[model samples]
Target: MRPDYPLKTDRLVLRPFEEHDLDDLHAYRSDPEVCRYLYTHCATLEDSADRLTKTLTMSELTEEGQWLVLAAYLPEAGRVIGDVVLKWISEKHRQGEIGYVFNPEFQGRGLAREAAEEMLRIGFEDMKLHRIEAQCDPRNEPSWGLMERLGMRREAHFRQNEVFKGEWGDLYIYAMLDEEYARAS
Candidate 1:
């Protein structure tokens, strides 16, 4: 089994989801700007709490397909400004998917990328994963750009992967192998 792990970057700490992060979860998940790309649409405080509880429950039990979500806290501001995750783990492939969300208020600060880089390190080096992939709606340019900036290549474009808000949406898949990450770093 792949073990849960924590990673740290210069200005961010990538760690498991905590019960105390309810406020941060509510703030961003509820924002339309933030949830535009998320599978589940914008959530309310109650909804975020319900989802957080479910995630925490699965994490506590070490469920195989569950994600380990990390809150991006800015110490100087004394707030959680964003989150990153390593999810959809497959033991057979030794691989997983990575995703992140930043508070609209924190969008320009570079905190999300800082947090994601640390999670990528854990997924590649500590977990010994063969591949890490990220999928985003093609129209979400910011997220797609982030995948490229993180050294992952755009590997596939699945046309009309799903219908989002009544419109057909295409998904762009970006991926990196452990060897590729090591070479680029």
Candidate 2:
């Protein structure tokens, strides 16, 4: 139930994050454009390093559940270009959330979609999670579209749910059930 540990797609390798991934993560995560719609403030190299270290060690630090933070790597370059994370929302409820971020340079190439599909398959089939949810800022049309393409239904729209960069922002929730995925497949 450790969320399949690692997931893979045709052109991408999805594996657990490592400390060595910090520098590569800093390259894109520190960019303003990449963090814009993600509601993430700009990150310095140090900040990215901190985040990478924390993500890499989260599982070891916890005793109950394993939260997999995976890096998406290209086969040709053998470099990480994105990350996908599955966080256990509650052990009792058996609920979890899925999140991802990709380098802008690699956007629109279906890399995110491929990685997401792989993660979804693992989440539903291997993890046995009852509900898998994804949230995004409403302004991020592409991300919303990606959720739709993944067959997740828009379950909720919370207006002004968060304040980011001095302004209120809307958050859209998309969810898929294991049964729903099974039926779709």
Candidate 3:
């Protein structure tokens, strides 16, 4: 399903990535600290451009494996501060996943939470999904904390589940069901 563009939140506009967003996208993505817990490393301008191209086509989630990515644009700042994503994981099971990343400059202000909550709303309400999950490195306290704040329950903590950044890494999974979402809402 495609979201109505420019999904409006209290203080931000979540929209599809545009050509002009390259500089802003690169600004934070190039920071090593911002990319620390993420799968991707600090991005160069070229890397950011390539990633931006991919995100441009991710506005629609019509099938399993597709991702719906939205730029989290802060109006007062007049630029994209980060992005939120929802992945269509399983069609039959109606399962999805939510994720977000914000510039360090905007980190503690609850902007990521605001954007991620919108993705959960889209997954449970608009996509009509049975469950939505989020996974993160166990050491990424802010990420797991955000998931908890969103009302998702900790579902699992897999020890040394995968090789990450050249080392074995633990993963923490958090999930929420549609019924859970309904009750919480």
Q: Which of the numbered candidates is closest to the native, going by highest lDDT? A: 3
lDDT per residue as tens, model 1, 1-185:
23344455777665556798899879888999888877887898889999778766433214448776667777777677787778757877888889988888877667777888877876887777899999999889989888998999999999987888788888899999999999988
| Candidate 2 segments exceeding 4 Å error | 3-6, 59-66
Better by TM-score, candidate 3 or 1: 3
Each candidate's root-mean-square deviation in Å?
A: 2.3, 2.2, 0.7
Question: Which residue pairs clash in candidate 3?
Answer: none
> Per-residue lDDT for 1-185 in model 3, tens only?
78888799999999999999999999999998889999999999999999999999999988899999899999999999998999999999999999988888988999999999899999999999999999999899999999999999999999998899999999999999999999998
- lDDT at 108, model 1: 63
Pairs in clash, predicted candidate 2: none
Give the per-residue Cα lDDT of candidate 3 at 76.
94
In candidate 2, what are the lDDT values of residues 1-185, reduced to their tens digit? 55445456789988778878887788789888878977667888888988898787553213225666788988877789988877767666757778888888888989998988877876777666789999998888888899999999999999987787789988899999988989977
Task: Quickly count the clashes in candidate 1.
Answer: 0
lDDT for 99 in candidate 3 is 93
Please report the TM-score between candidate 1 and the true structure: 0.89
lDDT accuracy of residue 185 in candidate 2: 78
Question: What is the total number of backbone clashes in candidate 3?
Answer: 0
Clash counts for all predictions: 0, 0, 0
As for candidate 1, its clashing pairs are: none
TM-score per candidate? 0.89, 0.90, 0.98
Candidate 1: stretches off by over 4 Å: 1-6, 57-63
